[model samples]
Every structure is written in C-alpha cells, then in structure tokens.
Target: MLENPVLADLATDLPQAVRLQRLAAHLRARFRCGAVALLQLEADHLRPVAVDGLVPEALGRRFAVSQHPRLAAILARGEVTCFHHDSQLPDPYDGLLDTLVGEPLPVHDCMGTRLEVDGKPWGVLTLDALQTGTFGEDARAALAGYRVLAEAAVRISRLEREVQALRTTPPLRAGDDERGAVGGDADQEIVGQSAPLLRLLHELDVVAASDLPVLLLGETGVGKELFARRLHRQSPRRSKPLVHVNCAALPESLAESELFGHVRGAFSGAVTDRPGRFEAADGGTLFLDEVGELPLPVQAKLLRTLQNGEIQRLGADRPRRVHVRVIAATNRNLREQVTAGAFRADLYHRLSVYPVPIPPLRERGNDVLLIAGRFLELNRARLGLRSLRLSSAAQEALRRYAWPGNIRELEHVISRAALKALSRSGVNRADIVTLEPALLDLESNTAVPPAAAGATPARPPAPPPPAGETGTAPGPLRDVVDACQRAHISAALGRCQGNWAQAARMLEVDASNLHKLARRLGLK
Candidate 1:
C-alpha cells in the first residue's frame, strides 16, 4: 500500500493525478466493504475513474455529473449526504451496482469525502461501509486531503485545451484565393481516415493544384461527387463555379445542345441564342457524372472539346474557345464499353488524364462512425432533434452494414430516423438525446423503406464477358483466373478495411503488384 507514495505526496506536494486504485483494492480487502469508488471531476463533470470491491464488469461505468443526489449534495455544499440503502437512493443507472453487490448499499454507515481543491468542488472519494453506523467525521476528513493532486490534473487538462485551440484555425471564405491552394480539412472530408484513404488524400493533395482532367472511378454512391468537389475546392479554379451534369439523365435529342451551346434558331426550341455548359463553365470545371452513359455521338463532340479546348455552337460555322477543366465520374467499365463500341476509345483516354478511384463504405475502416458524426451534426437541426448519440450496439450495427449507397445512404438513415423520432407525440426533444439501436433497426430490416420513398437504385454495370464466353459452358484459363482474382481482391479489401498493404500481404504479393492487379480489376 505504501508503494503509492505518488498519491500520498500529491495530497500535499506536486498535486498530479495518482490512481492508487490498487490501494483502494487493498483498502476494500482490509475493510470488507461492498464497494469503494473514486469519482473525479474534470471538464465540469463528475466521472467515475476507478472502483474496487464491486462487479468487475462495471469498473468503467460512468454516472452523469451531479445526477446522483447524494454525490451532488456532498460535492455541491460539502454536506456528506447519506444513502441508507440503494433502494432509498432511487436507481441512478438501471440498478447495476445494487444487483452486482447483492444488496442495497448500507445507508446509515456509508460515508465519502467531498474533494474540494482551492475551495472549489473537484470530486468525491468515497468508501461505502456496508454495516450500520460504521462511518463518522474522521473518514470524510481523511479523504479530503487528496484534493490538491486532483486540482493539478484539472490544470493540465486546461493547458491541453488551450494548446489545441491555438493549432486549429477557422476556415477561410470561398472568395479567398488561398482557399483553393490548401483545402479545408481534405483528409477529414474523405471520411475513413484509414491507411488507404490517407494515401488517397495524399495523392489528391498532389494533384489538386493542377488543372489535369480527373476521372473518378468507383461503385455507385461511393462519394465520387464529394471527391470531385474537394478537387475543385483545392484547385486554382476554386473561386469558379462547378457545374454538374448527369450524362445518363440527358436525352439524346438535346444532349449536344446542352453540352456545347447553340446559336439562335438552331432548332425548333432554339428561339434565342443560349450558352451551353461549356460556355457557362468557362474558367471553371464541368463535372460529367455517369460519363459512360453519354451517347456515342455526344462522346465524339466531347472528345473534340477535350482535345482542342474549343466548342462550336449549334448552327454556327466557327468554333469558340473555352478554358474549362473536366472531371468525369462513372460506375461503368469504360474499357469494356470501348470493346463493345458503346463508348469512344479516344474520349476515354482524354478524360482519364488523372484517375482516382474511391473505395466503398464497407472497405473504409471505422469511417462509418466518422460519417455518422458528420451527418448527425449537419441534419440534427433540419430533423428537429435537440440531442442525439449512437449507442454502442447501434455503432456496431453501422460498422457491420455494407452501405451500398455509401456516405449518401448513411446520411439518409440518420435523417430518416431523427425525423421519425421528432414526429412521435409526447416525446420531448431532450428525450431523444441519443440515437439508440432502434434508430438503426429501421435501416437493416428493409432494403428500401417507405421513409426513403424516392431513393433510386444504382444501376449495375454491363457484363465484362465476351459474347462467345457467355454462351460457352466455361471460359479459357486466363478469363476464369482473372474473374476469380478480382473477386478475391474485392473480398480481401472489404475484410481488411481497405488496407492495401494488409490485403497484399494476405494475397502473398508485393504491394506494388497488388496495386497493378487492383487497377486491372478496377477494385478500388
């Protein structure tokens, strides 16, 4: 017990934090008490840091600051409020302690000291006496001596907060040129912060400063738009507008006019001259979403613009020059499309000047929580939720889900759950303080819910097999081997949480070789 000299000196000397939890354990053994708990106050809250002589499982459980009446009275006014028994105290925490200790805490004999440092309430150091009338004034005074060290620990915390505040500055305005040079929390925006995502962010940082055409390849709803937006924000054209066009949404009849502006009376609908997306996005960026959906004819026009940096308005003879960077996104296999004559080989080469592939949510390690936290903050007010938190079980559920819609799907789940809770009658906003397992329950049960009424499914890509291979019973060795290899890498990536090195190690290949295979298989 004397080995905890650090704690003894802290009561008078340097006044730093000392656990002495071992000492508390020894004390419990010597005194034969039901429980001995150390509750420390920090950051304006009373947190239970250590415990002894009680259930081992409840060791790290915490009670809210000043929530328990007896503890509150002791710390608030230096009055040693006594609990005759656990039943008399009103169950503070679902009665875990009462059940664990096998009896209500002895009220008449139980005593604890109000730890006050520099005359301010810091914490409570208590020893519960199970027998009747076993504690008196002497015990409270003995525990009070530990206050000095507790105060020093609080000082250290204050210093650390100050240091962090100094390091993180506020974001710059959109108009600021500097905003384009250095992005606003680029890594944080990426969600996962996993090893693969970190490396991806590093690559983004290196490429964002240039005006290179970036092709984002990923499965549907894998946050390609977010990466494109980040790229625009970090580029020299940050101040310029970013125009988004879904190539798949455009009708073939008007796709050309929509892309490269038309002159007056070019067609029946062209009553007046109109600038197309190319002209509108002059000196900015044009994000061609679902690039593979562009008709072959439209693809030829797009190729010309990318190659020549010029656009010719419809019904006009001369071409007009426009300086605009292009960012294309596709969930389709462009290489297969090229072979099938659905997509232009020339356009593919032009758009993929710089390609960045995004991994799916299931492959992103622990990003489920990160995206969940961000979505909660963003939609809390819109959903009319006062306070919310994810339960441990709910967090586990979110981690387990393979989010087919990626970050977009996660946001929808949180928004739908919060709104549903708010609409419930007699439920006060404060009552909905935490998002429990029930909120996540709605997401997993149904693939599509009435709550997510208008959500469109992401269309699957076309087959990669050759026409002959599809009819045959089996393909050649190389084709079957390639199919198996892609499936293996994709499964391994999901299992390893997008850690390329670990996935490579499991596959027994060099990391560089794995990278080559991933590119060939299109498993990002």
Candidate 2:
C-alpha cells in the first residue's frame, strides 16, 4: 500500500524523522495481531530503531547482531526466513531472542524478515503473534507484503536513518525532546555528555519539573542564559511568557523601577503606572541574566520579592502579589563577589539554591565538530548553498582550535565558512578551501600566544602560499589595502569571540558589510 505514489510522497515529505518512524509503526496496525519492530543494523549490533508493542523505555535498547540464528541465515541468503521454537533452533542464537526481549518469542508465533537493498542487509522487520500456531502460510505472505511496504518506507523516509544515527550518541537527559509545532527537539538544544554537563542536565531535569528558582553559573558565552530559557520551556508555566532582564544593563538609578514596577509620580520621569518584569512574568519565568551585576541596594528588594512573592511598586502604598519563577544567571564568580562585598551574600545564597554550571566547549570532546556541523547545516540553508561538506583539512583545523567562546564560536565559524563558500565558486568542493590557510596565517600573525595565558595550543604548520603567489612585489596602493582589509577582519573576528554581530557593531558597520569583507578576505 505504501508503494502507491501518493503515500510514498507523503511519507518522504514528512519533515521529521520521528514522524516517518511513526509511519513505519503504522504497519503494526495493518498486520492486526502481531507486534512489529524495525531494527537498524549498526556496526556491531542490531538496535531497535523504531517499534510498536514494546515498553517505552525499551525503544532504544541494543543487542548483538549475531545472537539470532534465523537472522544470520536470512542475512546470508538476503531473503525472508522463518523459525519455530518447537524446531529446537541451533546454539548461540537459540533462546537469544527470548533473552533479548525478556520473554519467550514462541516458535509458532514469530517470523522475521530482512529489509535488503541491492542484496545487502539494511534492517530487519520482526513480527510476533501471541497465539500458538497463529502464523500460517497466508500470514507469512501478508508479512512479505508488509516487508515490501517497509522497504518503500525506508527509501521514502531517508532522514529516519539520520535520526537513528543521532540517537546512538548518548542524548542529554536535561530536557525532554520537544517534538510539537511549538518547539523543536529540546534534546538537540542542550548538547553534551561531559560528566559535569551530564550532572548539570540531570539536575536541570529535576528543576524544570518544578516552579523553584534556578540559578545558572558559567563563564561568558557558556550558554547560561540559553539554559535559563530552556528551563522555562520545560516547566509547567511554559504556556506563559518568559520575560528577560539583563540586571547588569539596568542603570543604578532605574534598576529598582525596572524590576519592581513603578506608579505614576513614583520617581523622576515616572509618568505612568508601569508593570515590572515580575509582573510581566506572572505565572511564568523571569530570567535575570548577569544577576551578580545587580547592585547591593537593589539586591535587598529582590530578596524581599523572592521571599514574599510580592512586590511594592515605587510610590505605591500597597504591595501587589505576583507569581513568578525566577531563573537567575551570571558569568561572574558570585561567591567571590559576595566575599568581596560587591554582591550581597544572602541574595547570592538565595539565587544559588540549585545552581547549574555549564562547561566550556573545549572540554566537550568531539562535540565541537557536532556543533560545527549543526551550524553549517543551518547557515548553508540560510545562505542558499545547495551542497556543502567540510573538507578533511578544515575539519582537522576546527578540531584543533581551542574554542574559548564555545558553541557561539562554532556558530560564527560555520556561518563565515558557508558565506565564503557561497561567494567563491569552487571552494566548496576543493580538498581544502583557501579560507583555512588565510585563517591560519591570520591566527599566526594576530592570535594572542597561549604562552601569555601560560598555555600553548599545538597547531599544524600552515599550508604554503600557492605557487607564484608568495612574492610580494612593491605595487599599487590596492595591494596594501587588500592586505590591511584581511588583517582587520580576522582580528575583529578573533576579538569579538567570532561573533559577527558584535564585530559589526565594533567596526561601526552593518553585518552585510562585514560579510562582504569576510568574503573578500577569505577569513572562513
């Protein structure tokens, strides 16, 4: 039935792999009486890629590929195969399926089929019936029909394989995968498995399930604010608005009014009754970034509201009650700040009730490349590049670079690379784009030596300049201008932690102008 072109197109066009997996699951309903499971063959094992009639937690388990004799026999022949428990199936594979599933897969009730393409095993489709002697010749033939549908399903939903590949990476346990129209995969949002990050995410999961205040501590660009917003999304108050206030951005004169709201005539230029962030986030979360930057006097008032869940508008006689979950974040060393008398210790303690510390990207081995790939995929789409791949040389450079700015740096580099590739016609397919050499050379000239920070980054010797292009003849002012332009763009990017927006702002130019410069300079 899936071979009908209409059904095939619909399945192929489903934007998400989970949806396609669910489509494959529809076969369980078609077969009526048998449990169905789709298994993808990985390098060393067969894993449950998608399934129906299994317990929820069992959806992601793995088993040895060699554990099933019928599977071995079927794979060897590249054809449909069957087994009966009453037939005393041979050693190693015998009783293996029962052990794998934690139940007896009755001989008379089970049949397995291989999903092969070009005579190679891609996956397996297994169906099980509860009744003894339930599956006969006709039933097996129907299963053959289902297997045909399964192959079509696989071809139609190619991205399902990508999703399965992603699942093999141990997923973050912090937030549930957001699969609805209103949200994307929350798991993809929080990406890491380092011991510190994993523990932090587990704690985040617990905190997200509650209405308590959560404080996040990390260095700049470590994604503390992002995590604060993620907490809001996973909470019961997700339907409500999440209001953000950069405590450090507020002026000392206006900080109180900005947070606690103000009544008409409350202070100088207080012309009207204005609701504060507390009011704006009533029933939701108030994410206060740079919480440590909040002044001392303002801290007392903030603590009062956290304790009482009520705020008194400036110049207002009565206090108004508000329901808001506060998620505070800071890049500063709050404990030290509190010790030094800059931050209020009591307020610091209150905000630090359940603190989560995010690790820097350099510490997340291999994740640097994962994040880079994600950003590349996004920027490639945004920039309208049809096909793009990171050359091995580029990948090596990326892995070697110490990402001080973490995920943010990866995003900028990918965006820069994509823009560079789009503008330069042949760079995308080359063994190594010229951009990397430029980037490396620029780094050699401008990068602050790690020795200054008392550490050194091991770097590969940069590629030599192209033949006949190394000699710098004294020439027109245009050559000098071109060299100056390349140097400035690379420096600005490094200084801004690879943030295009910030670099553009610092250069007093628009982002498009910076993109043009980056393209001309080949600073990918």
Candidate 3:
C-alpha cells in the first residue's frame, strides 16, 4: 500500500522535489497506467513537475487551463474524473507518449484527480491508458485515495523547505542591508547564492537605480541580457520600452537606418518611412550587444548620438531628439580595440561610465550546484524522469571543471548528462537517475588535476631543448620563451578547433591573459 511508503518518505529528509517525484512514480506504478504525470498549479498554467512514460519535452511544457478543457474539468472536480475514448476534447498528451512513434494515436481512457492542500488546489495527478475502460470504479477510488496522501506529502514538503530555509539562511550582510530599503521588482531568473554572484547582484542593485550608461563586461553566456533587463526594470524608465539591438548582427549598409530610422527614399529598398530602435526606445533604454562590432562610420554617428542625445535619420535633414539610457555589452576588450583604432576612445569612455563585470562560472564555487539544481529540475521535467541527481563524484567533477561557456555551458552539460543517463536506463525504468563523473565528459578541460582524484595523469610539461642544441637565431631568454609560448598556444588552439577560451583553460591560464599574450606575440 502507498500509505506506509508515503509515510516513510515524509519521515526521511529527502528533498521536497524528490519526495514528490517518488509519490508520483508510486501512484503511476500502483495504477498500472500507460503514463502518469504530476502537474503543479501555476498562476494560469499547469507546470509538469514529474512524469513517467511521457516524451522528454513533456516536462518543459506548460498547459494552459483554459486551453485544455479536460485538465480544467479535472481540476474543477472534487472526485476523480474519467474521460471516455471518444471524447471530443483534444488531449494535451497527444503525441507525447514515450513509447509512441509518428502521429499520436488517441488514448482509449484517461483519469485525473485534483490534489488539494488545506482546501486549496495544489496540482493534479493524471493517468492515461491505451486500453478502453482501464480505470474502473475501483481504480478511480484508489487514485482518489492516493491524491489525499499526495496532498499531505506536498504540504509537508513545503513546510520542511520553509523550515530548512529558516535554519540555513545566514544573517544579512552589509550589501543585503539596503535590499529591502530599495525595493523593486525581484529577478527570479538570476539564480545563485555564492559570494561572487551575491556581490554582482549588489553591484547590479546599486547601478539599476541610476540612469548612467552601463557597460556589462563579461565572458560569453554570462547572461548579460538578463542583467540588462534587470537594470531596465529597476530604473526610473521601467514603465517605458527597453529595446535591444545586436550591433554585431547589424549590416553596415543598414546599421544607421536600423538604429536611427529612415525616411522614404533613404536607400534602394526604402518604401515607407520607418522609425528605428532609437526612436522605439526613446524615454527608455537601448541595449547594444556586441557594441565593439560597430563600423567606424557608425561609431562616429553613435558618438554624436551619445554626446547630444540626437539621432539624424538616413536621408533626413533634421535631427530627432531622444532620451535613451544606453547599456552596452561586449566580451572584447574595448581598450585594446581603442588602441588598435578599431573602436573610438571617446565612445568607449562614454559607455563605460558604469562598468559591471560578471564573474565566470568556474570562479563561482558552490554556486555551480545551486545553478545546476535549477537546470536539473527543468531537465527532470523535460526528460520525463522522476528525479535527476549528480553522484558525489559527478558533483565533484562539475565543481572541478573549467566551464568556458559559463552558465550556458553548465546547463548544456547537465542536460546532456541527464539525457545520456536516461537513455542508458531504458524507457520503463522508474528509479532516480544518478549522473556519474564519466557522463559529464569534462576531462578535456577539467580544472582539477587528475592525479588528486586518481584519474588519468595530466600531460607532461614541454621539455627543455637539448643541452647542445643551437637555435637558428638565438635571442634573449624572454624572447625565446615568448616564441615557445606562442607556438604552444597556437597548437592548443588548433587542437581545440580554434577556441581561445578552451585553449586558455587547457593551458591553465586565463582567457584574457591568453589573448594579451597572443596580441603581444603579433599572432592575433
């Protein structure tokens, strides 16, 4: 019976999500349904929290209650609601069955019971069967009984989480002191509690209230756009539009017209008068991503706009006044670009009035696990797994790996590992899938030395030249070392498909340092 097992699960200290997953899996097995899913009630949609025998994408999908009449009907009922095979309402689970192929065939029967905590609907537990009349009166009664236990489990899980949060939360730091004082909309997307991430958040909070031009300097995939949005949300112009323009994506021919609008007859393709991003973002913010990619002529025009708050449209005699707070972001070193005459110095200075550098994932310590947990939950739903977890060795591997792609890379790694583990375990498997270190495939760029973990030995350092060997042209020791370093970096880059970040990680050096070294060696 589910009574004892559910009671035992609640007594243990497993994570709330894990406990819920177990209950859902148990109910699915107990009813012997073709598929079962546990959905959590969000504001206007139902989020699949756990599932079995559903396609991988089922978890990541949200079903609107209004759109899915069957789900709405089930949620409205106090008892289990059964749907016949010939029901006219479309099934949200169509083409979502894991065992199915090609087009989705109609299910013969389906049953659902709403789970409630304290008289409020929490979510719904659903069962589907390919055979007609699979859920008889007895099965329906049993599922309804299980729903009561499921609600209790969810309630206890929530309470336990609250208590745990209360216990683990540390006293507020100096940075946090002003958080409540300067309250605005909170960004739930930026997830992390590490010191570095916290410091970044504090800096973001400070700069978000001002209208100063901000420059977000960071590696690729460090979520610059998300931070830019947060800055816009906290500013005085929160109610106004926040327009984004990918400067690198803009064509040189259309860059001016795209940024500053154009009247008819401005260019060959110009048919009607059109307002550009600057006009669209007037009185608000304009986020220029990869601003370093702007052409020299566009740079000059951009400088004029920044200086006088005016943009002259293409083929127009008059300049239009605009009040836009610019937030520019780039992974490139603008100072280097300025030195190379690739970027204007004056524009660089203007955009960098408030520079915020986001820390990379490798430097964020345990924040990796915190961020991984968020992705893990999403993967669990997307992969239709009851639970996804990293083994102890896998967790250590993740912590020790150099994530060159930052949070974006970490997410892909976890997702790939989860999918790999799922496929290996088979379609009908119903246990918590634990991802081991081997599945992470992080050996190529792991920051932790393999010797420490008794894994494969690292490559030996490059040997010194033979005692009697003479160079073709001898130079200073520093020059010889620089030449050798350049050659080694070049080889590493080639092996890594010309990825500088990966080459840097492989060489046990910072990516910026590698770039500077390459530039000094005249190899850039």
Candidate 4:
C-alpha cells in the first residue's frame, strides 16, 4: 500500500468529483484544519467545486478574484501562501463553515495554493483553520507535495474519462459523418474534450438533476441555449414541453401577455384566450433567451411567478400556478443590470440560483480545430463537394485568429471559406478543395503573431525609409506608424462589426488601450 492514504485513495477509480472531495477531506483531517476546499477557476471567479468541511451553501457561491485579495494573491503565486494569524481580510468562507451557526466567526489563519496541471493554473486548493498557526511550515510543505499528487490525480482521471468517452462513443455512419453532425445529434451533443469543456459538462450533469432555476451566462454564440436544452433533456421534465421565449424579441406592449397568457379582449390583438410560455411549459422548462432585455414591469411579474409559482394572466384577477423550471440565458451581466436598475435584484438572484457559464471558442484551445473540422464537413456536404479540407496554413490561421463571435463565427468562417475554395477549385479544374490562409480572410495584423504556431513569420516592418530617402515624406516616421495603426485598428473594428471589445481582442490589446489608441489615431 502507498504510504500516503490521500494519494492512494486518489489512485482508485472513483469519480473525479468524489476523488476531489475525498482529497479535500483527507487534507482537512491530516492538517486538522477547520475546512478544506478545492475551487476551480472559472473566468474571473473561484467556484467551490469540492469541499470537505465548508457549509453546503459554499459550494454554490462564486468568489470574484478581484473582490477577494487573498484568493487573488494565492492565484498569482505558484506555491502556497498563508495569511497572517491576525489578518483582517474578510474571509470568503465567512459563515460558510459547517461549524458556524448564525453570524460568521473570523477565521484565525488561512492558506491557499494554486493548483497547476501541465503548467497551466487549473484552480486553487484552500485550507482554512479556526486556530492560529495551524498551517505551519511543515504543513505547508506537506500540502505542496499533496498539490502535485492532486494535479496528477486530476490529469489521470481526465485522461481516463476521455479514453472512456472515445471507447463508448459509437462510430458515425458515412452519411452522418458527411452531415457533420457528429453522433447524428448536433443539436443535443456538445463537442470538445478540453478541461474547461469537461468541467462545464460535469457542472451540467450536477445541475441537470435539480429543478433549481438555471442562469446560463457567457458571451454571445457560446451556445447558452444549447446548454439550456441539455439541462432540460437531462431533467425529469424531459417528456413535457420546453417553451422558448425570446425576451429581446417580445415587444414592450405584449411582453406581459407573451409570458403569462391573455384573456379575450385583454388587448387590441387579443381576440381569444392565449396561454403564455409559462403555462405552455408547465411541469417542464421555460428557456428565457436574452432575459436581460425584459422590461421592469415584466420583470416584476416574472419575479412574482418565480417566488410564488403563480402567474396572473392579462385581464385575470386569479393567478394560475405554473410548475415550470426556468432556465434563463443572457450575454449581458445581470448583476450590472440589477445595479443599473435595469434587471430586478430579486429576479436576478432567483434566476441565478445555479449559474452555468459556457466557455468561449477562443479560450478552448485546440478544440477550435475539432469544431472547425465539424463545420468543414458540414460545408462540404452542403456544397456537394467530394473533399474539402483546410491547408496547413489555413489551419494555422484559424487557430491564430481570435474567434470574436465564438462557435457561430467559426461556422460562418468555415462555410464562407469552403465556398470560396470550391469556386477556386472549379475554376482551376482541381479534384480536391483545400482552403488556404488567404481564403480565410483573417486580418493580418489582428491575427495572432505568426510565431505562435510557427506556420508563418512576421512581416518585417516596412524597410524603414530606404536608408536616407524619407519614404513618402509623410511627416516623421512616427506619423507614418500612427497612420498605419489607425488603418489597422479601423479595419479590425470593421471586421468585428463595430464591437470595440472584439476589435480589442483581435488586435491583442486591452479594450481600454484600444480605445486610447483609437482616440490618439483619430479613428475613434
């Protein structure tokens, strides 16, 4: 048997979450700490994925790194860092310890270390104690050793799961493969095996079993609706109706009626009684897409429905009870909307009882290629092409280009490029269609630096005035550079359809920096 019980336990074939929880429990027992928790880094927040001694509510709470100095500092470091015994920083685990009853008692000492896997920071492993100096130097050293084992366990578990997925996944028929919908269920299946994607899948699996309101948060085109559908399919209400309501598309005048039904003569167009989406989705799920666009009056009504499971239809005094499990989605930050008096605070909290954030395409690494291949196959089938593939250079370009529009943009890009390639091949009398980098139409400056994938070299800066000849006589070199910058930024903004944030991402600069550059270049 292995000397370390934690490591030995992790080596067993337990589920990933179970193994993680066991690790946390073991660490807590070994160190005699008040609590031990494993938090996963999701975007800008540290979400407790597994906990040993923390209160059950802590598992649902997400702590923003910026708001938590200790977490921010710990994430910044590669090794463990312990807070002072008398540190005054507010604990994220305040009132979250199982031992705590009413109000939060101050924690005496806290230590945290960033959990890294394959050189990437995965998350943080935190240990908190009620007594001072509980986590001494010896304990910190032991924790560091445990961290390595934790990472190994995670990697092993992930690899095993991926292997299992591959083994169990049925092979697609030639026709289905050509259709580009892997598994023959494009609408239902979520592709990619990246760590982030897998984590999301696991979160979905956990939340799917519950009837809690789910709020899907992510940038546009990250497929929040797809996740919502998956959640509904996995839930007990799969057999019931899954009603979709586009809050953004609903007019202010009809918003109330659209959500909560209308009796005859309730409004100018209400010729007959109409059951709203909530009633239509009774005992099932109501997916509210772009929920942030809901007007304040409608929001209040929605909140009432969420709170009391009752909805008063238009021109009706009595309320009808709805057994709908709501799954709301919005690219907009609802918390910010709540602060701005746009979204109701209570409604926001209610909808976000279980928030699931979808990862954007750019952040998903090589999964981009996998998704691109699916799109390529789709385009090939649509165009009736025998073969359509990306050239090595085209593949590099696709990987390098920041997918501002996420998966949706990727599909369009692949489709457009395939069409262009098909046209070119027809003109050239070629049997096979291969898309080149130029066909991708990615902005040169906005694309990732060529050194990234080693497929191309960066173009040397304009040969600099041809020795002494002052090229073009456009004032100084500074002016020429500024002009070039202005043109490049303008082109990027155009490519991103005037989304400044997307433009900034394409240009590989901070959004504020891009704004400053645009202003300085007179291109704002």
Highest TM-score: give the candidate number. Answer: 3
Could you report the Cα RMSD, in angstroms, for every candidate shown?
14.9, 16.1, 13.2, 21.5
User: Regarding TM-score, does 3 or 4 come out ahead?
Assistant: 3
lDDT of 1 by residue, 183-250 (tens): 44323245545667777776776687788999998875677877888778766677777888977567
Per-candidate TM equals 0.53, 0.53, 0.55, 0.53
lDDT of 1: 0.62
Off by over 4 Å in 4: 1-184, 425-430, 444-524
lDDT of 4: 0.71
TM-score of structure candidate 3: 0.55
Model 1, runs deviating above 4 Å: 1-175, 181-190, 423-426, 442-524
Local accuracy by lDDT, each model: 0.62, 0.60, 0.73, 0.71
lDDT, candidate 2, residue 394?
A: 60
Backbone clash count, each prediction separately: 3, 1, 1, 0
What local lDDT does model 1 show for residue 305?
96
Tens-digit per-residue lDDT, 89-208, candidate 3: 656675456554433445568999898988899989889887788899999888878877888888898789667644533333354331222233222356665789888876776777
